[model samples]
Target chain A: MVLKHIRNLKNRFSSIVSRIFRKKRDIRIGLYGPVNSGKTTLANRICMDWLGEEMGSASVVPHETREIQTKEKVQIKSNGKSLTFNLVDTPGIATKIDFEDFLKFGLKKTEAKSRAKEATRGVIEAIKWLDRMDMVLVVLDSTKDPINQVNITILGNLDARNIPLLIVSNKADVRKSSTTKIRNAFPGYDVIGISAKTGQNMKDLYGSLLKKL
Target chain B: MNLKIKFIPYEKMKMDSFSDILRDVKENTIILIDAKLKPEEESEIIEKTMESVSEKFSGIELSSIDFAGEEEMNNFERFKNIIIERIIGKKRGMTIIGPAKIIHKIKKNPKELLLYM
Candidate 1:
């Protein structure tokens, strides 16, 4: 049972108040998406740009960050614009976490099992933390299909909670990157194309993030 | 329609009876249900699926209508295969039962109730 915390409710209330008053300071902005979609990469980019440091390490293996990592008070100054908020880089959300999937990547049985367990817990923790977020950056891999079960479920959860969101189409540097498909998959929502690794179109992302706030 | 079956251990379950878990199951949906008995005992499932049977699932009280239909009464051989192939004689396991599309729909809805065998 991944129930919402009372602390989340209080934070949401204050966040609603902050948005109405146009106050961006200390706002909880979460990065949510599927595994290996470059959420940690994007988080690191933002942190590196403003704070001169990275929040956590990224891995080629799936579910590298199984716990929520936060970099607070990241004051972004870009394109002659600025906004200050807490960057909550969360674990990737997966509908299914099979140890066998990890085993295919050459992990030992025991290590695979423990990683699966931790990833499962991380998913639940991510959902519980959603209530505390005033806004979310729904990062998606532009090279993959956007209509996947994980993406739909993430969007559904965010919609059910009525949270404000901006879809960050990550990995646009890849040859097959297509933000149009993502826009079609989720119409009426703002989608921005950016290469978190190469820093392509990052200025547009900054402008969009400010609009979402 | 393709289907998948998985096993769930009742020892760690919070429910006392199969009906307790059955109450949260939605109608006309493909689902994994416990099917460990011999094919002959397919009759036993009849008792669990009776329209009049009611029980608690995860604390919410409901009835069998929430899970199955009389149509299931005719699928003994299918259930038998699920038992032999998936359960492999394990005293406890689950069988996927329903239209492939509905089952996929259930799987996609992350908020849907799942004993998730």
Candidate 2:
């Protein structure tokens, strides 16, 4: 009878351990930036490294991402805790153009105007959603000058809302890139230099995000 | 000295007039036109805007120069000369081109201009 009780206790303990290991915690992270700033590349890299597959493709065309794309069920281990993340990749924000401007891209004047209006609204929606995010990653192109109107506007809005942000200086492997300039442009903010193509400094990026979260 | 710099966007300007606006600007004050306008258009608008102030400050001597495409060194020289000759000596001020390249050019001389960015 004592031997039978010991075997039953071992089975119960194994069941409890399996239940705990099977459970997953959800964490939502938003990726945001201006047009052509490499938000998609970062998202893809994160997914590939952590999830073992690319979440999406990266394009050179401006506003290639017309809508928000999300990759869910990504499991990441941080601080000895297993957490699942729903990575949200958003469309690029650009100046609103009129119907005539859209027609230049081969759309009907009315259609172009409507699309432009939607694009404008999309940007506002994405920005407003920042308030609901657990964390935000603001990707900046290191090759460009740090003083851009769009960047300043985005940074100001994020700062005003007091949202926790990580400035990811993308394209670090490119020649003539100045990550220092980017860090200086926005003071007192956490900035990381990462090359998504070569996966350089990505582990550090993940570690920083885990720490912040 | 308290220098008030008012940056008026180009889209907001009415009557394309600047002279009447400059009449109210205090001496040693900086008027920054924070607009993405063409160089020639900005030059013409600035001249017409500060015409009244130029005449009133005849004793102060207002000398204006337009900075279109000068390099960093040349731009700094232009600004330094304007401050000494037009602003201090004449007691009247002149309007430089927009975008504030003068400030940026001067910043390069320092080891780190990141603090200001």
Candidate 3:
């Protein structure tokens, strides 16, 4: 217990020191969540709205993004205020990756196994990049229950690291989507509902990001 | 296959290296910790699990419940719980971690956990 406290204090001290001495770099805003939670979709939306280009492709298959995709110098203007940052789209994090699950999606056995390997590596990469995020947008599928282990762990780790964050309840266009449930589940955080597919409530998302940072 | 469940006290877990725990988990053992793991501890476990992932051992399914944090409490009650946890050196709850191959999903209800095998 004492060691845990000491470790936390050390991390806090180092974070403070880093903030004090850190030179001017592009503010990195990262998109992170569980697999198939629409992280890439939201990333594409943000990039398209700001940089007039899409960041990456979105897919129904899990772990479609197997690498870290970054779009630099994405500038968004709201209320006459402008903010430019490097937008990072990370592969979704997951605890399990059974190749058999992919077989249901009509992938060949060899292809599924290969994809599983890459997905595991992607999960590791996403975990490794958590420290680099200046701010994180935790994109969650609003149609699903939000009180899962993946969501809790991500939120808890970010809070422990003292990183600025905002929760995005994506897929709000779905009839079953419920932002109220998400808001209720995580009471202390700011959450905005948006459909990354149809670009619903994106203005509110941008405005919220500006206020958060 | 015979199922094995190991219950370890939080203090003992802190004393032992997590690799020892992971070794048991790799051998198809389910671990029950006396208290909810802190976020950093959970992250550390995840990192270690990723390093050990292979054809045989894919990964682990981990879930923790903080009984105190889950409840709606008045400020005084919450403060009292916090003090108690501080003195106990652990949170007031349990955590279950098992191989993902064995435990497909551990669903979280508000107050109880339902494991899907």
Worst 10 residues of 3 chain A by lDDT: A15-24
Quote the RMSD, in angstroms, for model 2.
20.1
Overall lDDT per candidate, in order of appearance: 0.65, 0.58, 0.88
Fnat of candidate 3 is 0.49
TM-scores of all predicted structures: 0.62, 0.54, 0.92
Tens digits of per-residue lDDT for model 3, A77-104: 8888888899999999887777777888
Error of 2 at B52 (Å): 37
Worst 10 contiguous positions by lDDT, candidate 1 chain B: B57-66
Write the candidate numbers in order of decreasing DockQ: 3, 1, 2
Error of 1 at A117 (Å): 0.7
Which candidate, 2 or 3, would have the higher DockQ against the true structure? 3
Which pairs of residues collide in model 2? B18-B49, B19-B49, B60-B90
Q: What shift in Å separates residue B15 of candidate 1 from its native position after superposition?
A: 14
Question: What residue runs in model 2 are displaced by over 4 Å at the alpha carbon?
Answer: A1-25, A78-82, A96-118, B1-117
lDDT of 1 by residue, B75-110 (tens): 785576556555543433334333212333233111
Give the candidate number with the greatest DockQ.
3
In candidate 1, what are the lDDT values of residues A1-213, reduced to their tens digit? 112234446756865775676453468899999889999999999999888999999988898899999888989866677888999999987544556668888999899877876776677677667767778999999998786545755765677568899999999999999999998877778899999999999988988888776
Chain B TM-scores of the candidates: 0.30, 0.34, 0.95
DockQ of 2: 0.02
